[model samples]
Target chain A: MSHPTLQELRDQLGCLEETQRRFSRTIPIADAVDRWMPHGGLPVGCIHEVKGASVASALAFSSILSARIAGEQGNIVYIAPDRSLHPLGLLPYGVRLDRLLLVSARRSQDIAWATMEALRCSQVSAVMAILDSADLTSSRRLQLAAESSGATGFLLGPVTSAPIAAPITRWKVSSHVGKPGQRFDEPAWALDLLYCRGGRPGSWTIEWREQRLNTLFNQLATQTTREALAG
Target chain B: MARRFLSLFCPDVTDDRLTQLVEWCDRYSPLAAADGSDGIILDITGCIHLFGGEDKLFLDLQRRFHRMGIQSQGAIADTWGIAWALARYGEQSIVHGGNAASALALLPVEALRLPYEIVLELRRLGLSTISAVRKIPRSSLAARFGSTLLWRLDRIFQQAEEPLTPWRPAAPYRASRILAEPISTVSAVEYVLHDLLQEICKRLERNRLGSRHMDLACYRLDGTVDRCEIRTSKPTRSIPHLMRLFEGVLETLKSGFGFETFVLSVLDVEALHPTQLSLSQANPVEDESSFNALVDRFGMKLGFDQVNRIRVRESYLPEQAVEFRSAAVSPIAGAEWPAYRIRPVRLIHPPMSIKISILIPGGSPVRFFIGERQRRIVRLEGPERLTAEWWRDSNSRWGTRDYYRIEDDQGLRFWIFRDSSEHWFLHGHFA
Candidate 1:
C-alpha cells in the first residue's frame, strides 16, 4: 500500500490536534487577562488553584471558572466540605444547576479523594475541590488524574493557604461590583495569576455582561504586561 | 451407578452456627445445604477424590469441626435417605456402596426424622426399626401412615431417589477466617480483611464474575455480630480497588470484645465482561465504566444519599426542569437537556418572599428587599408569564406567575416573579 498523503493525514489529525491544543494552552480571561499572568490562560488537563482572601471570594472565583469551563454537556463535579453552595448563586456565573454534580464530603481526605475521582471521568469537564486545607501528596495525585483524564481541575482554597508549587497555575480572585455607568450590568471580578509554569502571568478586570464574559482591556498588551510583572 | 452423599448432623450447632457450618462446607462443593430441619447435607458425589476419598475427607472434616469446638455426627452412604438416617442416629459411620439398605434397617424409627407423634404410633404398633417397618404390609402401612411410611421406606431402601430440594447456593462467593485467638487490633483486623478479600476475589476471577455488593460480618467472642455492607456502582472484580473502597468502611467497624471470626460474602453479583485494552487508548472513556469507580468511592466516603447528580427533565417549568437523584444510580444518558430561553443555575425553592415596588402598573420590578438588604433593580427584562396547572393539582387554585429577569446595583442578577395575587417572590439568582 502507498503511504498516506499529507492532506489525508492532516484531516485525520485535525480533531486530535485541536483537542490537545485546547487542553494544554491558556484561555481568555477578561480583556485585562493577559497582563496579570504571564501564562496566557488557565492550563487545561491540570489543576489551577484559585485562592481568595476568604471562603466567599474563593467560592465566587470557582463559580466563575466552573461556569466558564462547563460549556454544554456533562457536569462540574463540585466537592465541598459543606453544602453552603446555593444553587441560586451559580446562575450569574453561567453555570446551570442541572449541569452540577454536588458532592458534599465533610473530611479533607474525602475532598481530595472525590476531586481525584471526578478527574478520572472524561465526561466531567471541570471539578472544583474547595477545601480549607489540602495535602501535598493528594494534590499531586489530583493533578495526575486530571491530566490522564484530559479534564480541567480547579482547587479553590482560602488565600491563607500557603503557596505550594503543585498547581499548574495559581490565582487570586478579587470580587468587584458594578460601578458608576455600569450600575445596570451584572457584577465583575478581578483575577491575578500569581504564577504559571511556562506562560506569562497577568491580572485582568473581567465582567459578566449580556450572556458572555467580556474582557476589559483598555491599552496595549506589552506595556500592561510589563507593568503587571513589575508589580 | 451409585453416588456418595455425605450427610452431616450438626447436633451441637443451633441457629446461627448452623448457617456458618453450611458455609464452611462450601469448599467441598457449591451445593452445600442446611435445610433448617436438622444438619447440613452435601452431595459430594464425585468430589471425594479431591481429599483422598471418603476416609481422609471425613477425617479432615471431623478434625476441623473438633478444633472449632463443634460436635458433629457424619455418615456417608449410597443414598441421601440412608445417609441422613445414619448421621442423625448412629455414631459417625460410613456404609459401603450396596449396603445402604442394610445399614438403614438397624436405625430406629426416630432416625427417619419423623414427627414425635408418628414415632410414638410406630413404637405402639410394635414396629420401631426400619427392618420392622419393612416387615409390615405395604398397603397397611400406607393406610395407617398416609403413604409417607411407604415413601420413606422406598427412599431408605435406595429403591427410589429421595427428592432433594437443595437450598439455593449460599451467595455464589463467600469466604471466612476464624482466628485462633480473638483479634481486636486494627492491624490484625486489616490483615484478616485483606486475606478474606483476596480469597473471595480469587474465586470471583475463576468464575469470571464480578460482584457489586459485599457484606462483611465480624463475629465477636461475646456472640454478637456486627455487619457492614458496601455497594459498588459497577460490578467489579478488581481486588485492589475494592480494598480501597472498604478501607474507609472497615475503620468504622467495632472489633468490640474481639472478633473471633469474620465472614465476607458477595450479596449481589453479575457477569462483568472483560474490557479489552486497545493498543493505544488515546482518549479517556466517558462511559458508565469510567465514572463508576468515582461514584463508588464517593458513595462510600460520603453518605450515598449525600452525593446527588442532576438531570434535566422534559418540562418547561423551572422546578420540573431539573431532577436530582442519588449518585449510586447511573445518570440519565445523553446531553439533550430541554431547550429554554434561559435557565438559571440556582433556583430558590418555594421562592423567597421579598418586598417589591413597581414604577408602573404591570411594569418590571424596580426595587426589592431580601432579608434586610435592599437591592435597587437598575434594569429589568421580561414578563415571561406562566400559569400553574390547576387541573393537575386542585390545590394550585389557578396560580399564575409573571417572571422577570432583573439586574441590581451589586451587579448581581435576580429572577423575580409576581403571582396573580400581586405578591412578588425572588425565585432565582444569576450566579
Candidate 2:
C-alpha cells in the first residue's frame, strides 16, 4: 500500500484541530445568580476592579467572583498586600478558599507585579489584586497583562482616590451602618456604582436581606440627608 | 544452599492501578524489576529469611498476590531465563534449582530459546522435550539454529550470566513489620512505627550514611496500602526527626479498616561526615529546619496545593514581571532586573472603557466626562503607542492602542488610550 498523500494528512490534521477547539468552551460558575453582566460569567479576557474602603467588602467581592469562577472548576490567584483577610469571611460567600491561591506581598509594588504575572498564565481564570494604592500607569500595565493572559482581573482598592483607568467596571462601596431607629439586626450597606462607560453613576443604599444583598434606596435617603447636614 | 529465584508475571495490567501492585512487590524484595511489559522480576537473593525460608516465602508471596487483587504465575529456578520461560509456558509455580541438566529435562524444546520456526522443525524431528533437543549433535544444532539460540540456551542453563537492570537503585535499608493480629488503633500503628524506625536508624548508623528522603507504606488488611513520604532539608538518620516528619501523616491515617503490616524504606542516602563548626555557622539567625517543619505542617493540614510562593520575573512588560510557585519548591534565584518603571499598585480586570468628551487628536484629553460629573483635564502627557499582538490571533480584530497620561482639575491623573480603529476607551488612572 502506498503512503497517505500530504493533502490527506492535512485534512486529518484539520479535523483534529477542530475537535480540540470544540472542547474549549467556557465552564459555568457555581453560584448561578452572581453572573457577570456581559458574558453570563466574568469575561475571560478583561480586567475588573472592585474599589471599596474596608477590606471586608473588597474581599466579599473577591470571594463572590472567585466562587463563581471556581464553581466552573476555574482557578484564581488572589494577591494581597496590606493585611491578611480571614479565610472564614469567604465561607459565607460560598467560596472554597482551597481553590484560591493566596499570595502575601510585603510591598504594594510587589503586589502589582505579582498580579500582572498571575494574569499572564492562561490557566488562571481570574486574578484578584488587593492593593493599598494604585496609580494610572500600573493599572494600564495590569490591563494589558490581563488581556494577554486571557484572565479576568479584579482590582480592590480605596474609593477615595480619583478613578483609575484600569477596571472595566468601577464599584464604589461604603460601610452599611445599622439604622438608629431600627433594630440592631438590621442589615446595612453603602454601595454605589459609577458606570462611567455606560453613563450615569447611580448611587444605591443596600442591605443584606435573607442572605441576599438588597438595595434600600428609600431608607438611605434619611441617612444621606443626616450625613449631609453633619458635613 | 539452593539459589532460588522467583519470576512473577501479571499480564493484562492497566496504568491507573499499577503503583499499588509495584509497591506491594517492593515489600517482598528490594531488587524487583519490571519485566517484559507487565511482569515484575524479583531477585529473591537472601530475602527468604524474613519469611522463615524459601518454601514459606513462596507460599506467602502467592497468598499476598492473591490478597492484593492480582493474578500472577511464579517460577523459581537457578537461572532467570529458565524461571521466565517456565512461568509463561510451564505451570503456576515452577521450582528448578538442584542441577541445570535435570531442571531442563521436562521443559519443551521451545524453552531452549530457539525461534518459532526452528522449534517447530525440532518438534517435527521428534525433539519436543529439552532433553531431546540436548541430545541433538552440538555442531549440527549450532549450524542449524545459529549462535543466538545456542547462547540463549547456555544462559538459561546458568552457563552464562544474564544481568538484570533494576528500575531504581536498590535502597540500602528496608524495614518491614507484620502485625500478628490486624492493628486498627492509631496508637497501635505508632507503636509499630517505632520498631521500624529503630531498625532503619540502626542500618543507617552501621553504614555511616544519612537519608534525605524516606517512604512509609502502611499495608492494610484489605490489600490496599496508604503511603506517606517525607523529604528533609538535610541528610538525617535521627529516629526523632523521622517521627516528627510523620506527625501530620500519622494524624490523618484513616485505617479504612485496619492495616496488618507496614514497611519503611530509605532512599537517596548519602555519606554525612560530622564536622566541627563555629558558633556563628552552627547557630544561624534563621533555622531552615524549623521553617521547613512549619511549612510541612501547614502544607499537610491545609493540603500542599494551598501553599505557594510569589516569584518576580524581569520583564519590561509590566504584567510579565511576577509569578507564583509551589511553596515546597524554591524558585530560580538571581535573574537580571528589568529597567525600572512606575507600575500600578493595582490593575483592573478587562479595562473599563471611558467616554472622553474632548476631541484631542494625538496628545491627551483636555477634559473628560466620567459619569454625570465632568472633570476638566489639566496637564497632558504621552501618546505611547502599543500595537496588539497580531500573531496570536490571525483574524486581528483589535488594532493598536495610543495611550496617554492626562491629569484632571482635581489633580487626578488617568491612563487613557485610543484603540487602533480610533475608538477611545479609558484604561487606567494614577492616584
Candidate 3:
C-alpha cells in the first residue's frame, strides 16, 4: 500500500483507540442498553449520573443498577444522607440485603467522603451516593477511586439545570404512564440517555416486572434501520 | 528465683486517695491492689528487674509518693504478710530471700496481723514478740485465737497462698510507654499510638490471638485519664487497621498539660490461627480484607450506628418489617427475606395526611391534595384492610386502616391508607 498521509495515520490511530475502549469491562444491564452502548454495556470503573424528577424514582433505578453491578461475590455500599431508602423495596429487584451496606450521613461532604472510601475498596463492586449536590472536584475524586478499584459508581440526585460534572454517562429517568388503558400494569420508566461518551444517545420506555427489564419498543431493530438509512 | 512481694503503707489517706495510689502503682507491677484501707499489695515477682532492682524500685515509689504530698513507707519481701508487717513496723525496706525466721523474731506480736484482742492477750501472756509466740505450740495458738492467729502466721511464713486481686483486671495483651517529654500534639500522640499498636500486635501474633476490643488510655500530666475504645466485627491484629480506627479518636483527645503515659490494652481476644499469605487474594471472605476495614473506617468517621446493614423481620407493619443493625458489632449473614405482601421501596415515615375529594361519596378518591399541590389518580388497586395489632399495645390510636395502591396521572405510584376516622394519609412510594 502507498504511504499513508499524516491526517490518515492520525485517523487510524483514533480508530484503534476507540476499538480499545469498546473492549473495556462492562456490566450488561439489558439487551437494549447493551446494544446501544459502544462498550456493549455500562462501563465499569467509571461514574454514571442518574437524575430524576422524584427522589424515589432515581433511587429505584439506582438500586436496580447497583444490584446488577454487585454480582454474587461483590458488595454494594449506599451512602444515603436522608436515610429514606427502604431495603425491603429492594427485595423485588433481587438485591442481596446482606451484602448491602447503608451509610447514613447528614452532611453532603460526609456523604461524598464515604462514597469515595467505599468505592476504593476492591471488595465493593459498586457505590451509590444519594446526596443533595456534588462539585466537579469531588466527582473527579470519586472517578479516580473507582478506576483504581474497578468498582462502578452511581450518583443519584434530583434533576438540576446547572451543569455539575462530566461523568461517563448521564441518564434521566422519569415515571412512564403506560398507554391510558394499560395504567394498571407493572411499573414503567421513561429513560432518556442524555449523554454518552463515544456512544450514540437514545431514549426508550422500559418496564420493570418480575425482576427483569423489558423494553417497550424494538430498539435493536430501529437502531439497525437508522444506521442503514444513514449509510 | 523466688517470687517477690511489695507492700506500701499509706498513712492518713482517704479510701479514694488509696484507690488512686493503687491504680498509679500499676507502673511498678501488673498485680497491684489496695490492702485493707491503709496499704497496697503488689506482686512484683518478675517486674522488679525492669526498674534495675527491688531496692531502687521501692525507693523510686516512695520518692514519687512523697513528691505527690503523700506519706508512704514501703517494703519488699518474699510474702505479702511479711512485706505488710515490715513496711508498717520494721524500718528495713528490703528483706533478703532467707532469714525469714530471724526477721520475724525481731518484730512485735502485732506483726502477725491478729485482732486487737488477740494481740492484747498475747501481750498479757508475756508473749510480746513474734519469737515468744513461735515458742508456744501451734495448736495452742489456734485454740486460743480460733485459727485466725495460725492463718496469719502461715501466710507470713509462706505456708499459705494469698493472691492479689489487681486494681483492674490485667489485660492479657498490653503495651505501654512513658514518654520522657510529654506529648501534646496530634502527630506525637499518633506516633506513640503507632508504637503501642505494633507492640500489642506482636504479642497477639506470638500467641496466635486476635483482639476484638481494644482500649487506649492516655494518662495526662494533670492526673486525669482519657480513654478511647474500639470494637471490631471480627478479631484482627493488623497494625494499620487498628491505627486507622484510633485516628479519629486522637483528634478528640484532650492532652491536658500533655499525655505523660500511653497504655494500649486488648480487652477482648479470640483464637486466630495464622493463615498463609496467598499470592492472589481471590477470596475476600477468608481474607477479612478491605471490606471489614471499610466498615471500621466508616464506624470511626461516623458513629457506629450510622453504618448499618438492613434485615427484614417477621412483622406486618412496614416500618417494623425491617431492622437496621450496626455492622461493626454483628456479622451480616446472607439475607433470605420471606415472600410477603407487595411493599414500597421508599417508606414515608409517619405518613403525611392529605385532603381527598371523591366524585362519589365513600368511593375511590379521584384527587388528593398534599399541602397546596394536587395529584389526580388515574387507576386504583386497593381496599386491603389492615387491623391494629392489639397484642402489641392496648392503647394504640391506630384501630384499623384500608390501604390502597394508587397511581397518579403522572405514572407515580403511591401507597395510601384511610384510617377508621375517615382521614387519608400518604404512606409510601413505588417509584
Report the C-alpha lDDT of model 3 over B201-293, residue by residue, as the tens digit.
888989999898898888766444677888776688888788877887888898878887888889999888887766676653334248888
Using lDDT as the measure, the top candidate is 3
Most accurate candidate by DockQ: 3
What is the C-alpha lDDT profile of model 2 across B304-333, one tens digit per residue? 444564444543332334444566554456
Q: What is the TM-score of chain B in candidate 2?
A: 0.71
- What ranking of all candidate models by TM-score puts the best one first? 3, 1, 2
Model 2 ranges with Cα > 4 A deviation: A1-231, B1-4, B9-20, B33-40, B65-73, B86-98, B110-118, B137-148, B159-174, B194-213, B231-257, B266-289, B298-306, B336-340, B348-358, B365-431
Fraction of native Cα contacts reproduced by each candidate? 0.39, 0.06, 0.73
Stretch of 10 with least lDDT, candidate 1 chain B: B282-291
Among all candidates shown, the one with the greatest TM-score: 3
Residue B268's C-alpha lDDT in candidate 2? Answer: 70
TM-score of chain B of each: 0.67, 0.71, 0.77
**Residue-wise lDDT of candidate 3 within A49-128, one digit each (tens)?**
88886767777787788888887777999888766787887777767888889999998789878988888888898888
Ranked by DockQ, the better of candidates 2 and 3 is 3
